[model samples]
Target chain A: MISQIAFVLVLAAAIYFIQKRFGRIRKNINLGKNRDFKDQVDKRLNNVLLVAFGQKKMFKRLIPAVLHLMIYVGFLVINLEVLEFMIDGFAGTHRIFAPFLGGFYTILMNVFEFLAIAVLVSCVFFLLRRNITKVPRFFNAEMKGWPRLDGNLILFTEIILMIAILTMNATDQLLQPISDHYPTTGELFFSSLLMPLFAGLNESTLIVIERFAWWFHIVGILGFTIYITYSKHLHIILAFPNTYFAKVEPKGHVNNMPVVTNEVKSMLGLVSAESSAPPTEPGRFGAKDINDLTWNNLLAAYTCTECGRCTSECPANITGKKLSPRKIMMDTRDRLEDVGNSLEKGGPGLNDGKSLLGDYITKEEINACTNCNACVEACPVLINPLEIITELRRYVAMEESGSPASWNSMYQNIETNFAPWKFSPSDRFNWAEEKK
Target chain B: MNIVTMAEFAAKGESPEILFWVGCAGSFDDRYKRVTRAFASILNSLDVKFAVLGTEETCTGDPARRAGNEFLFQMQAMNNIQVLNGYGIKKIVTACPHCFNTLKNEYPELGGNYEVIHHSTFLQQLIDSGRLKFEGGAYKGKKITYHDSCFLGRANDVYEAPRALLIALDADLIEMKRSRKTGLCCGAGGGQMFKEPENGKKDINVERTEEALETGASTIAVGCPFCMTMMSDGVKNKEREQDVKVKDIAELIAEAKGLS
Candidate 1:
């Protein structure tokens, strides 16, 4: 009875903290400008299924895809067993479903055991890839500190959690015959291999080990749930919504600024009858901080798992440029968190003086992007680093008139000559007269 | 070769079936001029009634928008839309993917809408309809590789049209390791052609050219004039200008049909 109350208290605490942190995150995301992604219901659902559920883009890198699939599938299926553990914790019953499920319970336990072993093996391989082999994507400049540690920590936790499950099952099998409280769950196929080691232990000692393993496994899971809210692993939950709201237009199409369009229409005397009134006060031209970006952009930043697939595939990054698309998303999330923290303390909020540009992301990094959409195409979750880059660039060009001199000259030539070059417009058809 | 203008078509109280949008590169760049003439020659031979926008045509503001000058972009877009709408243009074709993308995708929002087609797709249609035929072409069985223009391939999803045209030439179309949706940029997009690239280990064109050369194909086929200049400069940088040649798809098709 005492143990069950402790379990209830711990579970309630986990739920309370998870809710508080998630609420804070949602508030931070809402600080950005609103844009409607509610259109095209069918297409968005399809994207959620294919990109998020089906793991379609993950298959681009075949080896990692297969390994990740094992963990992803294993982890999800094992959580079903965790659900039973939760019920057993509340009711103080051992294998409560065993009586109702009867023979079917044995099959389910075997499948769960097989998946746990797969999870353990995959996690070990993942840890080696990150630490020993040191995959280039995992070791990029942005991945130096917490990002790297966070990755390895998640893998390590999964390995420990899997071992706890196997240990609990093995010890429980020995206690089933001696303790009336422990039900017969049949011999779990994978954990039975380890029963030989615990077979000679006294009944009291085996009961203690089983109970201890149960507590460790459930507590570890609760801790992981809270930790992910603060880690890059939040992608496991955000990927679905992020992929659902992904841009449905062609990859090359950059959205037109409606405010600029209005001003230009009035200037050219081309305004329609209804919109002919003077344009509203022109606000900031483009994104200088988190507030200027759309909510979807913020969602993307949080959804990014620092996979660096985008950076590895980026032409600018590959050619040793300062631009790393993965870094862009990471910086956005970091800055957003900073802003969120400041706001929570009743501070200056967005006006904390520092901004996304110049402070978090550099001018050289945004300039290096070719807008090739390679990063967009490469993203597994449909996050668009290119959109944020362009928005920042727009802020620099329009708000500050800080474009490079060569680009300013090109803009001038286009203004005067109706072309980027200084050549006359009358000469546009001269190529037709050239005798080839 | 005589090329008609939109003004001439309007003066005769008639309209051509298509308006050939001769972009800034096709108008000004010396190398790309030959591509313009080659496409024009093919159109003339096929007797497809087409009119050039000529001097009335202007930059589509693709560079301006990409460089983050939305004000300049909207201005250029509005001005061009006025002229295009004035002509009541129903269909348009261009050899430049950048111009095609802007005219097709961006212009519609500003009330400029038309059936915009890239020359690669335009030529493919001509071939598909049997309007253009080839006989024992110059590139017959020659291993030629096609570099995807980002604007054409990923921007608009027009990957198959260009490749289909190459196949019609009786040429062996070898693909680069990164082609179609995953194709690399030629270091000239997003207004990079107008300025130098940011500090990097190597230029993007040099990297892309190395991939093209790795295929061991003698000729590199391109659809965009920007890619043409970049790939040609890359081959020159590698000092393989004599051994390897960069030819636009239009020029290749023109040569295949004995039109140029």
Candidate 2:
């Protein structure tokens, strides 16, 4: 009875903390400007199914795809066993579904046990890939501090959690005959392999081990649930919404600014300028910071898992340029966090003086992007780092008039000559006029 | 061979079947001019009845828009749309993927809409409809590789049309390790063609050219004029200009048809 109450108290505390952290994230994401992703209901849902649920993009790399699949499938299936733990915690019953499920309970436990081992093995491989083997993607400049530690931390946590579940099952099978609370669902196939090691242990000692493992496994899961909100592992939840709201248009299309259109129309005499009323607050031309970006962009920043698939595939980064798409997403997230923290403290918020452009992301980084959409195509969760880069470029060009001199001249040539070069429009057909 | 203008078609109370959008590169770039002529020659031979926008044509503002000068982009877009809409143009084709992408996708939102097709797809369609036929296998069994233009490939999902044209040339179409959707940029897009690339270990075109050379193909087929210049420059950088020829798909098709 005491243990059951302790379990309920722990579960309540985990839920409260998880909800609070998630609420903070929701508020932070809402700070950005609004853009409608409400159109194309069917297509959005299809994206969620294929990109996020089916893991379609991950299959581009065969080896990592297979390894990730093992962990993904294992995490999903093993959680079914965790559901039973939740019920058993509340009811103070061992294997609560065992009586109703009868023989099926044994089959389910075996599958969960098999998956726990699979999860354990995959986690170990991932840890080695990050630490020992030092995959280039995992060792990029952005992955230096917390991002690197965060990657390894998740893997280690999964390994420990998997071991705890396996140990709990192995000891429970042994204690089934002696303790009434330990129901006999029949021998679990994977856990039975470990029966030889616990064979000579006393019944009381076996019971204590079984009880301790159960508490550890459940408590570890609750802790992980809370930790995920604060970690890059948040993608496990955000990937669904991120993929759903992904841009459905052709990758080549950059959205036109309607504000610029209106201003140009008035200048062209197509539409009369609004009577010079007392000047309203001036609107920002482009994203000077997170608040000027669309909510979709903010969602993308949070959804990024610091996966360097984008950086690895980036032509600019591949050629040793300062632009890393993964770093762009990370920097955006970090700056957003700073803004969010300031706002929570009732501070100046966006006017905190420092901005996303100069403080976090550098001018050189944004300029180096070719706007090739390689990063957009490479993202597993449909994060469009190119969009954010362009927005920052927009800020640089329009807001600051800070384009490189060569580009300014190119813009000038286009304005005067109707082309980037200083050729006459009459000479446009000269190539055709040339004699064969 | 005479090329007609859209103004001439409109003055004659007629509209050509399609308007050939001779982009800035197709008009000004010396090397790309040959590609422009090659495509025009094919259209003339096939009796496709196409008209060029000629002097009335202007930049599509792709560079302006990409460089973040939205004001300049809108001005250019609106001006071009007025001229295009004035003629009541129904269909358009261009050899430049950047122009094709802008006219097809970007122009529609600014009230300039037409059936825009890249030359690769345009040529492929001509072949598919039996309007285009090869006279001699000029590139027959010659190892050729197609370099995907970023705007054409991932930007607009045009991987097959260019490859299909190369296949029709009776050429052995070899692929680089990175091709199609995963294809690398030729260091020229987003106004990069107009300026130097930001500091980097090596130019993007050099990296892409190395991949093309790795394939050991004699001819590098391209769809975009920007890619043509970049790849040609890359080959020149490697001093393999004598052996490795970078030609537009239309130029290859024109050669195969004995039109150029």
**Candidate with maximal lDDT:** 1
Q: What digit string (tens of lDDT, one per residue) describes model 2 on residues B1-260?
A: 59999888888999898899989999998999999999999999999999998888999999988988888888999999999999998899999999999999999998898999999899899999999887667778899998999999999999999999888888999999999989999989888888889898999999999999999999999999999999999999999999999999988888877778
Off by over 4 Å in 2: A272-282
CAPRI band of model 2? Answer: high
TM-scores of the models, in the order given: 0.98, 0.98
Q: Candidate 1: lDDT of A181?
A: 89
- Candidate 1 chain A least-lDDT 10 residues: A274-283
At residue B66, candidate 1 shows an lDDT of 93
Q: Write the per-residue lDDT of candidate 2 for residues A1-436, one digit (tens) a residue.
A: 9988999899999999999888888898998888888789899899999999899999998877878888888977888888899999999888889989989998888888888888888888888888898889998888988999899899999998888887888888888888887778788887788788788899999988888888998999989989988789989889999999889989999987877777777677777446433344547888889988898899999999987999999999999999999999998899888888888889887788999999999988888888789889989899999888889889989999998888899899999999998888778889987865
Enumerate the candidates' DockQ scores in order: 0.84, 0.82
Query: Worst lDDT window (10 residues) for model 2 chain A?
Result: A272-281
Candidate 2 residue A395 C-alpha distance from true site, Å: 0.6
**Stretches > 4 Å off in candidate 1:** none
